[model samples]
Target chain A: MSGEPLLEVKNISTSFFSHLGEIQAVRGVSFYLNRGDVLGIVGESGSGKSVTALSIMGLIEKPGKIKQGEIIFNGEDLMKKSQREMCELRGNEISMIFQDPMTSLNPVYRIENQMVEVIRYHNRNLSRKKAVAQAVEMLRLVKIPEPEKQIKSYPHEFSGGMRQRVMIATALSSNPGLLIADEPTTALDVTIQAQILDLMNDLRARINASIILITHDLGVIAEVCSRIIVMYGGTIMEAGNERDIFYNPQNPYTVGLHQSIPSNLAISEKRLVPIRGTPPNLMYPPKGCPFSPRCSYTMRICLEEAAPTIRLSDTHISVCWLLHENAPKINGYSKGKIVDRYKTPSGS
Target chain B: MKAVDDVSFHIDRGETFGLVGESGCGKSTMGRTIIRLYNVTGGEIFLDGTNLTAMSEKNLLPFRKRMQMIFQDPYASLNPRMTVTDIVGEGILVHNIFKDRERQERIFELLDYVGLKREHANRYPHEFSGGQRQRIGIARALAVEPELIICDEPISALDVSIQAQIVNMLEDFQDEMKLTYLFIAHDLSMVKHISDRIGVMYLGMFAEVAESYELYAHPQHPYTRALLSAIPIPDPDLTRKNKRTILRGDVPSPIDPPDGCRFATRCPLVSDLCTKATPELIDKGAGHFVACHNV
Candidate 1:
């Protein structure tokens, strides 16, 4: 791995033009991925995590467009690429896996046909026999038993877990430099989810590819990611290394998300401090901070002015008015203090 | 090829017995079986000591009023065309609980109880958000004043921020109405928080059953331990350091499960005996039930 970043997304903004109005889905979200890094993007539905990934893949269609942003990959600007050029780069240099394996895979086609086609498509010089052989090896790499026989079966013949494994196998067959997995385990069960996560972690180590894992579950992010970015209303609320974000959270939204998750370590006796009110409507986004309505420590300034990204440390940054130096102190809004209040006495 | 085989548990008047499992583990099937939505193949279902399995449809009508269900996908469960008032009031009308203005007032109160405004009563399902739609679903379930509510993955469909709101609302309702819940979900942490007693299911049978704290603090079954360890705790340091028991393969098909323990195919400590005979849900101690040959 070199010192250069694998992917750099700078001030990307995306919007969907519907009949009713324009939805500001991704509002100036930015992040960078390093080589061999597993970066997790944690956000709820309509949080622009999916949209941002789509923007990177150049999958956004009519009515949806990337308004502004510079997506530089391997020192080249992706936005400047032609559709044909982007298409060439999509599966060859960058691979992606979606949430539902059923829809992502073709039900009528055999797994061998799908996996081999992807491998052969990327390596055009390879012979069909070699492609098939590579496909079988990839299947085995994902730990699918009886890969030779299973490869001939249709997607429906495989179980949910097996199908996802097949999807991972197909994605990795291309040997892309960057792998974007969007809620890869959300549709599977917890035990099966663990299996997939373990496989992903193992594959990441062996393949030497940077992974951008997008999910709403903080636990999943904590488990696999080296770095994380918390997004809300399509904006990056906080970005930091895993320990800095988890142990020393500075954003109120991030803190709320951490407290909301019911810890398996202990049965919580008290009610979870739920972030009141629903997510802000993306179509009619708030004038100032999008999270102001639900924020507990919302001051008049929060409702009037957009929050600036405050650098808490060299490795941590949060976009919140509470981080302002002249901001009035709240009981639990102090830097690193909010996370301590919710820490289990026994510790994790 | 039974989806749920010989699963039995009792819920007291005001207790919440949570059923937790991975997808396709028959937790939802168990919930449906209990509510009589799916016919029981070969087991007795007793409600307040009455054999609900023996009752015919005509006789089961009255019991249906006392047993309600909140589905997982609020988007699909509610009729998009129907107004919230009609949707919530439909149950009351069928049960003949109230009439005319009284029914309308009851619907408004149910809406208010679930944290929705009176103005929302006239809106359609499509008009409301996911959490709001779930609230409407809850209002519909509570319309008939049911005693036992089957919450089948109620919070899974909503956003993280909104999940807590629904959970808090459910807890408040449980406290006020003394409603017994058979909550079925895959998320173990949330189940631990809300359930008085929790049952871990695998394939189509109960792997372990214990009081909430006991189950989380000291899970006995290998499947339970693996399931618990697999759950990513929010703390990065703790989760990264925790040793995970990653199962070998995917869950076997339920069509023709192994003759022995359903989990024997993937169990880490599988032995010849495990593949030869089935394990019964036996009481270990202090009401903790485990169904594993090794245990």
Candidate 2:
């Protein structure tokens, strides 16, 4: 726990060479994940959260390529690994679960076949009977009722939530040190989402796996993540612990996101202040901060130059010109001000 | 086997009645049935005390102008080849409300109301983003000057920030035009924020119905309580403190749903009575209604 991080992504840039132009999906994104850390990367669609995950998994194909930077995992640079080496390390050391379980799973194969194959793939010497038993135990760990019976069912026979549970079981069957889940619950209903998230929390403790959860819902991040990374236009706008990002947010995009969503705790009398304009286009990304177009406190400098990462604390960092020393102070943008504003009830 | 079975509700003038449920719960079906997209197989639908279900196509032609729908997928709903002007002005031309330059002017005004520029009229739907295309859809719905607009998961396909903008615009339009809305969505938080009254549907039946605040604050039905508690609160502190009621398994299929209560298969408080007789929606006083044997 005191040594280097379990995974460190250093200034990685990924782009797709489209016919029109180069689509810069992940532009110099850097982050680290420690042992047992549940890091949530929160961003909207086209923000390149999924692309970053795919790049780390070495799954980016065709026009897409990881142009630069290193992905160090357990003292080894994953970027230097051969495709054969990556295939060996994928299920054995790192596991991933995708958004839609139906697509990720083979419809023709039974759940037992998928889980057994993954289990046996990681451990070449394991007997088929032992692998099947381990598969049943994994399904049982995820609280799937009648695991032995249900393991015989096809992917379509399972419900959306059950299929996701099966996916989690299959992902964890290898017992990888790192689990990268991309929008794991976005396709399921809220009630089932709660179930899957709860199961993840339970499994994280039991398996001791470090998780990188990627999602567009801030609420989901707040629910599970110990640390949060706010991404926009394929760049990290802010990275901090949950409290720093939620209660004492420094980035305008982070604050704007909190203000935009209607809180279930609060009644509906006041209008939500929406961030105007759409997300930045990646093909023709802005030279300065990606949020400068929609930022309420944008200055001339914010649009002219890219913002440097400002360290507010040991754990909190923000990429915004407003955090600069020479920048003028804006009301309600001060430290810990958002907590007071959200604490007060809007109305009954 | 009915998509929407034995559901009765009324929307008062200028009131937004939200219908919320998980996927395949018939909320969308209910919305379509109200707008006559799906013919009513069993029950009658009345609009302002007029029986819409009994009217013929020729007789219902005028009523069609009084009701319109905004679809969920902006990418699929809007005609790809049609320009924004044709998309919005088609209703005006069809209903013969305006013509030529006047029709064009009305289309421009509707675009402005929905936060689109005049120059956007000539561009096709493919050129616009999801949020912008939804605005175009809104403009089209408003062009007919419909009193009741059925928004079928309009903001579900949008991002959170853009969702707020669209919700705020819908609110403004409702206030300005005194329009009623049948807002159907699976997002509980946004639905609660925008609705006056909400109906909780499960397997083609209304499980709960009450004022929005009442439904959220003191949810009575077991299904309603589980659904509300399941929503992840945005505030970290609140989310940590919240004791969620995590339901087991997925919702049972609507086809040949377990006898009596549709939720009986998943309800934590299920009893023998719940398996034998379906509960009726009984008033729990203060305009709140719940359908459950335990309640």
TM-scores for every candidate against the unseen true structure: 0.96, 0.97
Clashing pairs in model 2, backbone N/Cα/C closer than 3 A: none
lDDT tens per residue, model 1, B14-68: 9999999887789999999988999989989998888999689999988999999
Q: Which stretches of candidate 1 lie over 4 Å from their true place?
A: A331-348
Docking class of 2: high
lDDT of 1 by residue, A1-348 (tens): 667687888888999999999999999877788889898999999999999999999998989999998888999999999999998998889999999999999988999999888988888999999998999999999999998888899999988889999998998888889999999999988878988988888887887778999999998898789889889998888888987788888889999998787776765887987899999999998888989999988989999987877766667778888977778876655543222111111011
lDDT of each: 0.89, 0.90
* lDDT tens digits, residue span A1-348, model 2: 677788888888999999989999999888888989899999999888999999989999979999998888999999999999999999788989999999999999999999999999889899999999999999999999999999999999999899999988988888888999999999999999999999888888887889999999998998889988889999888888988899888899999999899988779877999999999999999989999999999999999998877767668877888877778887655432121111221101
TM-score of 2: 0.97
Worst 10 residues of 1 chain A by lDDT: A339-348
| Number of clashing residue pairs, candidate 2 | 0
